[model samples]
Target: MHIAQDDIMQESYPTVLQLYKLALLVPQSTAVVERGFSAMNDMCTDLRSLGQQTLDSLMRINLYQEELLEEDLELVVDLFKNKKERDMPL
Candidate 1:
């Protein structure tokens, strides 16, 4: 007895593939959200009053400028000094 071999290619299931794609698109962790809330709380404590824009700016700088956070105070002061210089020469 000889058995015939069926050569057939099967397409991936659409629903399974879509579900997988959706899973990848969704965030796996809430850590980022928690960190953001924590940062906001730290910036807006009872003793300190910060406007929404100011708080957002501070949070952005704190989150993005990890290296700047460690920089020397003199360096930061110098940056502000240079930034404050007038464009017109005396």
Candidate 2:
């Protein structure tokens, strides 16, 4: 007597399925935006001066690559070493 969700969606609830698809497509909510602002506040202290582009890049890395931030600095530095010829040590 149990019907699968896909079967139910296909059989008699096309409108519901369409609504569900639209809901999935909706953009992220305000919490993400608030988190971005919070990150900006934390990163932009008085001692450090950053250009707008640099600030944006740092904020993005802070917010999205949080887990990567927890990793070892040497491993992260190694990634940049291969990208270009460096005149000085990293």
Candidate 3:
């Protein structure tokens, strides 16, 4: 039934995004995937040491047999933010 499909879609993605209209979130729909790419590209584009460059690749390249997902980037950004907050002196 249509209702069952609706429920399935809802459970599959974030609530903020409409399940039927996922294609309209151009550039990005839920989270900013490009920002991280730009960050990684900027970091990787210029390099003096090979180890740091490899690290950037590892962080940007998703290891789960895919490029990357929006949720994955958000989690990475959140992790970065938390670290920054924890390191900041009160």
Candidate 4:
């Protein structure tokens, strides 16, 4: 049997194409996601739920911890220390 290149090219292999696309989307490992979850679990508890923004910020700080040094920490502390407190209205 002889087949032309055009015939092969024109064939609609939707299933194969879709499977290939999905394969590309699959992660090689779930370790990173699992690690993040583990960190979150350690940081939070059943009795205390953090706000979404606070959780996200804490996650980022935890993730990039290796990049932060003692000086960086002190600077962060200093900034918060110097920040003005907002007055509460009755």
lDDT of each: 0.74, 0.77, 0.58, 0.78
Backbone clash pairs for candidate 1 read: none
In order of listing, the candidates' clash counts read 0, 0, 0, 0
> Model 1 off-target regions past 4 Å?
1-10, 67-90
Cα lDDT of model 1 by residue, 1-90, tens digit: 211121221134556555656777899899989999998898899999998899989999878776666776678778878896658877
| Candidate 3, residue 81: lDDT | 83
Model 2 lDDT per residue over 4-69, tens place = 357866679877777877877887778988988888888888988788999989987887685766
Model 4, span 1-90: residue lDDT tens? 322224453376656655666887999999989999999998788997999999999999888887876549889888879989856778
Model 2 CA deviation exceeding 4 Å by range: 1-5, 25-29, 45-49, 69-90
> lDDT tens digits, residues 16-42, model 3?
346445555454453456656655566
TM-scores for every candidate against the unseen true structure = 0.58, 0.53, 0.25, 0.46
- Assess candidate 3 and give its lDDT: 0.58
RMSD of 4: 9.6
2 or 4: which has the higher lDDT?
Answer: 4
Model 1 TM-score?
0.58
On a 0 to 100 scale, what is the lDDT of residue 89 in model 2? 71
